[model samples]
Target: MKKISRRDFLAASAAVGAAGVLTACGGSSSTAASTAGSAAASSAAGGKSTDYPTKGISVICPWSAGGGTDSCLRAFCEAMGKNLGVTLTVDNQTGGGGILGHQAIADANTDGYTIGMITFELATYKKLGTSELTWENYAPLCRVNTDAAAITVGAKWAADNGITDLPGFIDYCKAHPGEVQMGGSSNASVWHIAGGYLMSATGIDIQMITYQEGAATAVQNAAGGFIQGVTVSLAEARSFIESGDLICLGVMDEERNPVFPDVPTCKEQGYDITYYTQRGMAAPLGVDDAIMTRLEEACAAAIEDPDFVTFMNNNGQAISYLDAQGYADYLKQAAVDVAAAMDAVGL
Candidate 1:
């Protein structure tokens, strides 16, 4: 796959900005897919916009380096910065299941320069009542990708225990309750959320191991016999899966992933729950209308760039684009969905 250089991506982003006015006309009602695609293509070729990126931008990622959030946003922010004629540097402020990064952006002046990725943590943290941070804390920029969970098992363990697939693994867990340990990246991270949902749906008592450590480390621990199961973003264990170090049991999604089409979804396996781990940017609350509009346009351009799409696809991301209001709507619905899920499990 050819990667679009940051410089070109920036150039294209600028062009798209110029087409923003045109987009407004079409934006009144969502256009057909073909029209939207054509508009996006023209915007890419249109030329740089005059009202963007007078300076560098700071994109705060809540997770550590090399994690799914970092990798996905790095590709996107780099492309977006190129489009906007600025540098988008990522600052890792990891802790408290993403509260640190959330707080950083929430506390920062809504100057449009300091934006950060907000994940399911945005909702999960609220349920935990850890801090006052919620979707309202930041300006919803655009969603780059949202991930459904993947059931990953250490390669060695799968072979040793003869649990080759999801059903077999579940059967084994049912046969030997409490023997199989499940490790989560964070207390309420999507990884653990899927495990909890699975436990409730399956009635399997898989021991939950809390490791607020990064996803890679969590997968390593699972593969190393510290635990037997892990649920994480596809990006987190992509390399391991390639090298046969891990086996994905089932992906916690409604549709099967094209790349991992062989893997079944939790629903396919008779589980009714579906949870997503999303990555998107939001500005601090109280951003000016002009700046917010510019930021939203820039983010939209970033999401539409062909290069960005290719990058996300290659990196195991499912494109889930939503503008500010759409993202806000998602948050509102998510609060209800998450609240219901939590109640179902009595969390």
Candidate 2:
């Protein structure tokens, strides 16, 4: 397969965005898709008479209820609804590693009433041969959160091995190669990709283990010494870290996370590795530009809301917001980068 550069990918993605708008406008009139397209075009043409969102909107989440994605969306939608003057209901359409919910949002009527929270799994769906959904399938709205990956070890395991920092951990892994067993959510997951990226960048090798149940189980296993380390979001391991059962070696981010300011970043430890799980809201491919703009503006306000900020801080999730265009650019580059990282791990 040919590699697409960030610039080329963005150009092609932008073209896809334009084509999506055209498809929405020309879709069946009997469907909500057509309404979405026409409404957006009408708003763009200076028609300010349409009172958009007279009814509640349904926001789809690809993950199950009670998970990080679902919880974050519920809180965010509440704040967003306050700004938009309408209720935003979140529906958990879980399955197929988040493909079902994403597809539901993509196939829903483009009429701004239905939107979804697209997760990092969107970038891997194609490469993993699970689903063809891409950034092009949805109209980019705005990014809500980004949780950086962290390398954590069992508290006893770290002390026993004398691994006090990233350098020490790398040295240990280099010396003991496949002896260091690392666990994550699953194969080709964001955590797995982060681990793969770390190995490729530092020339260290370790056995990659997958936990089908989720990162929580994997983190628990690590704390119990069933595994030497875990490459999952710090939020997943926050409880264990707080309990002193696990130690965060380093977070894979450009800067240290505020919730865990005592922990050093991979960059600060001399390795420029940064990887994170991004969650954002996106509407179906033909939402009216006006409606989309309104949604984006509302989302921006929701992110700045004190309640939302408090929710994020209390939950240990990082607040990293990116606008529509910026998010589109990010998805384009992320798809390429994720593919490269997956390939490095022979995924």
Candidate 3:
């Protein structure tokens, strides 16, 4: 896959003309028009407030700039701003393993102007005792991307072991218990939980290795043959897979990702394991409902923008858009599921 620079993406987005607008019809007579205009103004004032976002909006990204989350957030924000008719600034407040930035979002004024990108880590921070932050602290706006975890192995290792698919991997793990080391993101991370879930679901034991930096480093180690396999997001392993340095055995999702449709899901391979890292937008708790509605509308339009879709597809990022209420429901279930998995795995 070709790398899409920030500059290139912005240029492409700028080239695409503004999305089409919808207009309402008005009566021909002056008296009728005046009455219609007055009714419209009254309706707008009583319903969704149209005066929101008078100034620029600030989007706090917990991760460092140029990372997957930051890059996707920037692209999404750029597109969203067009719909909102204001600039959305992304501030990278990186520290405390994403806690600082999330806290910033939670602690910011409860206005629609301040929002942030919340990641899967939100489900683990409380369980890990790192912070008291939870999904309840923020009102979810929309879910942008959900990249599923995948089981990938170095080409040489797969070739040497005669493993080509999930069943073969399970057999190999069963035959050589604790011999095949599985590397993923840091301990208690989403990737680590995914690795643990895989083992539990398949009834196989493999030594779990934790990489502090993240899945990218773990994937790099796997491609270099330091480890047998890696349970990381497919996006992180895309380059290696494209170069034939690593082979993705199975994706831990209910359905196969569009970017790698040939790779079967874990369930399709007879293993009932599914896991992914979800990224979405959220505002501080207590934000007005009208402002939330406005934000959600803008988010929906941004995710559907052709330019944004093209950028995400080229970068191997899966597009999973969810509306506000749907996102809230997902967070509730995700909290329960994450807590159970962490406790079972002793994270």
Candidate 4:
């Protein structure tokens, strides 16, 4: 797989920013994939309309109702509804570790009435042999959020092991390879891949435990000392961390998270490791470019919606907005990263 340097990514992102505008006519969609292997297929084929969205838009969520992805998508739909002048309904089509719902989204009719949230799991589907679906299966609109994984552990476990910080935790893991048990969300999930990335970067082996139920159970188990720690987002384990039951060793981000400024980054601790679970909105292939542009514009405006911003901030999720082309690029690069992680963990 080819590596996308940050400089090159930035250059491409700049190009997308300058190129992606409100103009729907002949707009260049660099990342939006058409069913015929082109960029953001034409309206003459289907869904061409001047008075589009005269009806409600169905937003498919590929996760459970009460999960982080669901909540975020619901709030975003509300904001986007205000922009699009129509109600956006959330339909949870969850199963197969997000494969079933994802397939449903990709297979949905391209009438511009149905769209869905594509998650980080999309990058791992092909490598996991669960599905052939990728970002190319849909027309990406914009990236909504990114939650960085954290190395959080039971406070008691850390104290007893004299692991005061990330360095100490890494030393302990190196000394006791495969003895440490880290509970990531589920098999092939983003947090589980974070564990694999950690091992690949540090040359240390640790047993990765999967919580099929979700990260909540894993965080609870870690707080109760059933496992050593978890590689979940800070929001998933925020309650335990607040109660002093779980100690965050470090966040896997380039800079410190504003919500938890006290916690340092893994790179700051000399491990230059960064991993995140990304969520974004995308329509099925062949949606009209006019409809896609309208949806994309709504997404851009909705990001600034006060209610949505508050919901994201209160929920401890970071808003990392990216346009269609940028998100498409991100998904493409993520496939490479996830494939490498699959190899690292023998997945």
- Which residue runs does candidate 4 get wrong by more than 4 Å? 1-49, 340-345
| Whole-model alpha-carbon lDDT for candidate 4 | 0.72
lDDT (Cα, tens digit) per residue for candidate 4, span 1-347: 01111122221222211211110000001112111111222122145544666777788877665456776788898888777777778777766767777898999989888899987777767877889987789999999988777899999999999999999999998899668888766566776656666766666667878765456667788899999898788877787889999999999877887778999999899987776677899999998788788888889999999999998898788888999999888777766655654554455
Task: Tell me how far the alpha carbon of residue 185 in candidate 1 is from the true structure, in angstroms, after superposition.
Answer: 2.0
Q: What is the lDDT of residue 99 in candidate 4?
A: 78
TM-score of every model versus the real structure: 0.82, 0.77, 0.77, 0.78
Report the lDDT tens digits of candidate 2 across residue range 80-176. 8777777778777765656777899999998889998887777777887888988889888988887777899999988988989999999998898
- lDDT scores for all predictions? 0.65, 0.70, 0.71, 0.72
Return whichever of 3 and 4 wins on lDDT.
4
Q: In candidate 3, where is summed lDDT lowest over 10 consecutive residues?
A: 19-28
- Count of backbone collisions within predicted model 3: 0
Off by over 4 Å in 3: 1-55, 65-68, 288-290
User: On lDDT, who's better, 1 or 4?
Assistant: 4
lDDT of 3: 0.71
